[model samples]
Target: MKTKKLLTLFLLISGLSFYFSQEVVIKDDKVLLDGKQILKAEKINVLQYSFYSMKDDEEILMFRQMDNETPKYMDDDYYVLNFLTEKTKVESTDFTKILNFMNSRKAMEKLIKWLLKERVINNDGELNPERVQTFKEKYDENITDRTFR
Candidate 1:
């Protein structure tokens, strides 16, 4: 029957959708990507002094990608910038490294704009200071050290 075929198709589609659903969550020093927790470069702070001492380099900044692709927002409403870090390791990073780091932070800024919009959207919406503060603190922890381009 056509109705039976439609029902089977609907169930298959729903199963596929559920299988692909993802939620972004930061847990401890890592984040869940597509439901898997991976260490975050942005979260891992390399002390500028310590790393430099180990590597004996005078680069102003050092950084690396977190190895996770950024999540795409629902219906392309917004995009999470690939979280980048300039001060990935706090050793003296070179100017080129610094530039790269800056770029990463800039990506974060895009994410921030989207986040702020979300905060304002909730409840028509209220700027919950406590929530805002929490967000600020977390956001700050990730970046706010060196300039991101």
Candidate 2:
């Protein structure tokens, strides 16, 4: 009947609206979340392998760099490392390769503690501090020099 068709049409429209409301998109190299620009690079640093985001309203950090020699721009390396390790499974070992290994180890330990406090992973995650330490001991037995040469 006409009533049944109208009801079906209304439901279909509502469902479609809801489904498209949360969609995110990338346009012109900018990341748009819910139709708002969330991430747009303002400057690209090729040597550092980093960039600054255009949006400042978001809770996420905007500045990121990979260079080990230059002074750190952001002071939240501990927090950033924790988030990066949790989200990407990548550690900042390239810095250790260039700088002091001890410094990197200390930073990694702090990152582990931060990850634990944030509860980003379950107890059994392999990146747990204790597990990482044990693994490092077993595999990295020859890395005794902690100071940069």
Candidate 3:
């Protein structure tokens, strides 16, 4: 009886773990968060653009790769600096919105460090204000006159 109880308890814990497991997968150019499609990518010209659809909004967040080269040993180089409407309308905006949103927040610090780690931005000095400013300039330059799919 004790052995049966122990086995039942083990089975119960295993079942619970499986039930609570969350899966993240990128299959067929679609990003699946917990088995739900959140973002989808399409190759356009030399860049691969991914659009994220919000459940409650008609607008979708758009991201694009900086270059055509896919990083084999690193994460994909993309940034969410734009959005689009349901009718495939591109929104005219700049880095101000992203900069303001991330300013003075922990996300800003994390992004700066991540950019440095990914070699997206140079590390002149930790206290240098131009580190982020330089990135803003590059972002604005590349995002100008974007072609939408």
Compared with the true structure, all predictions reach lDDT values of 0.33, 0.36, 0.41
* Candidates sorted on lDDT, descending: 3, 2, 1
Highest lDDT: which candidate? 3
What ordering of candidates by TM-score runs from best to worst? 3, 1, 2
Q: Name the lDDT value of residue 128 in candidate 1.
A: 40
Can you give the TM-score per candidate against the true fold?
Answer: 0.26, 0.25, 0.30
Better model by TM-score, 1 or 2? Answer: 1
What residue pairs are clashing in model 2?
A: none
Which one wins by TM-score: 1 or 3?
A: 3
- RMSD to true structure for each model, in Å: 18.3, 15.5, 15.8
Candidate 3, superposed: residue stretches over 4 Å from native: 41-149
TM-score of candidate 1 against the unseen true structure: 0.26
Model 2: residues with Cα > 4 Å off, grouped in runs:
1-13, 16-20, 41-149
Write one digit per residue (lDDT tens) for candidate 2, span 21-49: 43334345444445655444222332221
Model 3 scores a TM of 0.30
lDDT of 3 by residue, 4-56 (tens): 99999999999998887544444575545466664453434332343333344
